[model samples]
Target chain A: MSLSTVAGARLVARKDLRIEQHSRVALAQMLPFGMLVLILFAFALDPSRDVLTRATAGLFWMTVLFTSTLAVQRAFAVEVDDGALDSIRLSGISAASVFLGKVSALVIQLLVLEAVLALGVAILYNTDFGGWAMLVAVTLLSTIGMSAAGATYGVLVSRLRHSSTLLPLLLLPLLAPVLIAATKGSEVALGQEAGQSWSWVALLAVFAISYLVLGVVLYRPLLEET
Target chain B: MTTTFAPKIIGTSSPATRILGVLSIIGLIALVVFGLVISPADFELGETIRILYMHVPTVSVAYLAFIITGVGSVIYLWKRSEFWDLLAASAAEIGVLFFGLTIFNGMMWGKITWGVFWRWEPRLVTTTVLFITYIGYLVVRSIPTDTRTRGTVSAVIGIMAIVNIPITHKAVDWWRGLHQSSTIFATVDPDMRGTQLFSAYLGLTVFLVIFAWLLIHRFRVAWLSERARGIGLDEAIAARRAEGSFS
Candidate 1:
């Protein structure tokens, strides 16, 4: 019998997160890498200029975008190595499930990373957060949008020979709207810019929803290629 | 195996293509005349009105090509046909070229009119995003892979990437609050009389013909390369056999 989408999603997610829990890749590597990036921004733009404080939202999201590429690369690496994806295929689960599973796991991991990054931004960039409602809304939508798009493109490039180098090239341009929306919305949230942040949040919702739909519909074909 | 090793005629030209070429050339001459000498300068835009003749059509054709690419991607996925795949890839290649022209012409328009080559305006950002999306598409297409895999992955991308144009436009619009006077066509030239309208229409028609001509050529080249690869595989095997069993 073909596994139900929900069941398959659960199984795959559990498998991935369980593997992550054992390996500590995200905790040990991604979190610190994200923090180092936060610190490096300080080095790149001297803190005395107070540019980081004024530009906190942009730097924070830009850092997330960079580290998320690494996260996506690592997420796909596990399946592509050692014939694991092939076994998953033979088990009669849907590709959509695998896509959803990977995206969910990436979402959780990235949320954790973003949380730490938010803290880093608070401490290092000296950002004072306000507009709590829009802040939470934009963060949630942006993460989902990033994770869904990343997962879709992630599986597409996973099996390629130069996939490590190729994934960002394929994924980053697709995520431009998210970056713009998230940055602008977060700027409003952080009291750096003044405007209708909800409209930007709406754009993020539209982006996240469309990518989620596209990811579900297109995952089968992408997985077959893999 | 005894075989005819003669090189296959891979010429993409034909009677139809020749007709397209001739029509395109004729249209282009007319477009130039209408754009430069025939059409009067606008009350507001002056000589800068001429750039719109090229700019508007290129942007229109770029969007048209991308829409076609999206449709082709959908059909390719549904039918699993190489023809649709080739059509999608061809349209995308042409779309990228047109978008490049659009961006360049747009920059000229912006600099002359607004005193800057680039701005954070909605159209500019949206255009650049679409351009970059297809650049990624073209880059991924260049990587060696099985035909089906390449087609499948590219089809998936083509389907989703098109959604970005609207999302980007909206995001930038919301972010920037879209000043009405800042735009080119909307505020200016809402109503064109006589020769001005004619020239605008003429430019659009000519560029469309040019786009069709380019699309046909690009599709033929992609199809030809695939055939050439197949023929090359046989030749490589034959040459290996002639080397006396791995000599």
Candidate 2:
């Protein structure tokens, strides 16, 4: 809440954006990769056209989960690779602020990726968007929760030698609840006949806010750790 | 002859310690014999409820270990004590062991009860995930070269992973799970019998006692190893300083 904290967060966000802008490779790599996954799912499942209607929400969320993993890891990869971590810590800024800034940037990157994937699902599988507005709400909620928890764990575990292998192991299990709620929420928003799936949407919202608060508070100790 | 501060054994080995040991032994005996014999045959499950003797207790104990780990983590972080960190890590490692048994026993049970070895049942799925996360914690522990770093990082992870459990517990309510409902503990009904209820408590108490004993031993070992490693480092540094002074 301090001015310095806000400034620190802004500075960290700007720094990440600048890094992404320069290489732009991280952004470029995921789209084709994500599309390929979608292609594989389509070929593999071979669901009936009627089946696609019911399956769209699951398929859409699956795409987001995998693609977001790819996109999210890169958020910290660059900073860690260049030893910017130590410098950031030494800059007299709060670590929690840095975590907020990193999570914010991740949300932006994930939103972009999810947007593309959502469109892909819509075109490929005829995903209904009747209550599309709620879909967006669920998407945002799930994205924030996933990124906040993922980024916190990713940052803490990044220093491990086998982190690339371990990150998902640590992340996906925890992310399952978020995935379930979000998928169900999106289903309801898609106007599929389901009984009171709005409960899931509420859960997603609660989950996101909880993670946001928790990640901010817990980030300091983990940041100081590395 | 380990010079490490093991859990203190008061004037007469401590009443809590004696009681815990006796209870653990008796419970293990009951689990092996009484759980197999005295518990009535399930109308549906038959002899396989015998498997529940092991399978059910393993899952119950694993959960108990994790809860203790969570508590230990909170204490470790707050007090900044090596004792609490060691306790947490020991509990986590043992929890990992028990959780693995839980999954293993559950899979075998599932193969019989559910006609398949694995399904996306919320109970099994969540527990499996928790087990895997426990292994991930070990990986986290393996990464940090220093004791303090390892302990502290693992503590943070232990705490975070605990946050995942409530969701895991509620997975049955949230998803289309293949697992049966919690008969005894569900909001809709409580179906445990007098013996069944007694057995559950007996199992929990036994596991807690075993966990305490293991924690004390594991913490002692960890403390000693850390001390030994510290000595080695100090000697190496001293040798380097001597070389510098001679030069």
Candidate 3:
């Protein structure tokens, strides 16, 4: 909550975003890959309009969940080279700042992915969007939880030689709660089901807050580790 | 001098452990007898309740094991001790084993009682996810790396994985609640009388003892392997040096 912490977080987030901007991995690669996954789902499922329409919410977040792994890997992938993380550590920013920073970068990239996937869902599935405000809230809350949880696991496996494979195995199960809340919340937001979307959003908020807090507290121990 | 003929201890064992092993064996037999024969069928659940006798114990012990793993991981992070690292790793291994058994027994019980091997119930899903998370912890431990690095990573996972358990459970619970009544799994009703109660309690005690026995042995194995790895590397280095000098 210190201004310094916020400033440090912004610094790291900007750095990651800058790297991302130059590389265009999120925009060029992940966005296309995410859309392709949506396209693939249409093939896997009954490409018929009704089924795809019902499944849009789940599939969108599921795509987000899958690609968040890539984003996280890239987020920490930047740090794995030439002891960049070590330099960052020696730079005197709090570990929480570094963690928040990474999560922030992840959230931005996933939001972009989600935005495109949302359009893909609308177009390919012939779906209509309703509850715009609720949908945006769900997207923000769910993306925060997903990114925080992803970043936490991301750094834990960052240095392993087999990290690319190991990261998803370790991460996906932990993301179960976030996926459930997000998918369900999106379902309600899309009017595929009745009742309160906010309730599910509140559930997502719980997940978001829990992982954010977890990331902050646990990041220091892992950040200091080799 | 004549060499004395002494039997080699080929495994992690000693006099105390032997006695502990024997006690668990006896307790297991008692449980089997009570659970299979002496215990009467519940009016509601009937003979199927016997599976509960096994199912409850394994899952409970698994929970206990992971709790130890969590605690061990925390202390290791704090104290940087090898004992806690080995203990955490050992407990997680046993926890995975017992959780596997729990699932197997649970599936069998479900097949018999509900005519289905699996259901998308909250408890079932939560248990599966918990199992996988610890499996991840074990995989992290197994990754080839420096001892401190491996321990540090595993410890972080051990801490984080346990924190996710309750959250996973709650999420699944509400996830289920959204659609239907959350009957997920049944608990042993307190109205049980006589041998049924005795068998249930016996099953729990016996399983706890078995878990302790497995944990102690597993810890010894992990500790030995680490020591052996260190010594093996040194000997290899020494041998290569001698070969170089001779050449």
Q: All models: lDDT?
A: 0.87, 0.74, 0.86
Tens-digit lDDT track of model 1 for B98-198: 99998998899889988999877678777888898899888878889899999998888898888877887777667667645636534226577788888
User: For residues B56-155, could you state the per-residue lDDT of candidate 2 as single tens digits?
Assistant: 6567667777887788877876777888877777778888888887777777877877788887666677777788888888777767466656666777
Q: Taking the tens digit of each residue's C-alpha lDDT, what string does model 3 give over B1-247? A: 5558564455799787787799899999999999999889878777888888888888899999999999999999899999999999999999999899888887787787679999876777888999999999999988889998888889888888888888788788878873343232445557777899889889899998998888899999998888779878997998899899999
Question: After superposition on all CA atoms, how large is the RMSD of candidate 3?
Answer: 3.2
Q: Candidate 1 lDDT (Cα, whole model)?
A: 0.87
Name model 1 segments beyond 4 Å from true: B1-5, B185-188, B238-247
Candidate 3 positional error at A104, Å: 0.9
* Model 1 chain B poorest ten-residue lDDT run: B179-188
Deviation in angstroms for A43 in model 1? 3.1
In model 1, what are the clashing residue pairs, if there are any?
A: none
Model 1: per-residue Cα lDDT over A92-207, one tens digit each: 98988998898889888899899989998888887788889998999899999999999988888887778888888878888888888899999888788888778889899989
Q: What DockQ number belongs to candidate 3?
A: 0.73
lDDT of 3 by residue, A1-226 (tens): 3348788899999999999999998999888889889889989998688898888888888888888888998888889976789988888889999999989988988888888888888899888898888988989998998899898888888888799999999999988888888888888877888766687788788888988997898899888776
What interface RMSD does each of the candidate structures achieve?
1.2, 1.7, 1.3
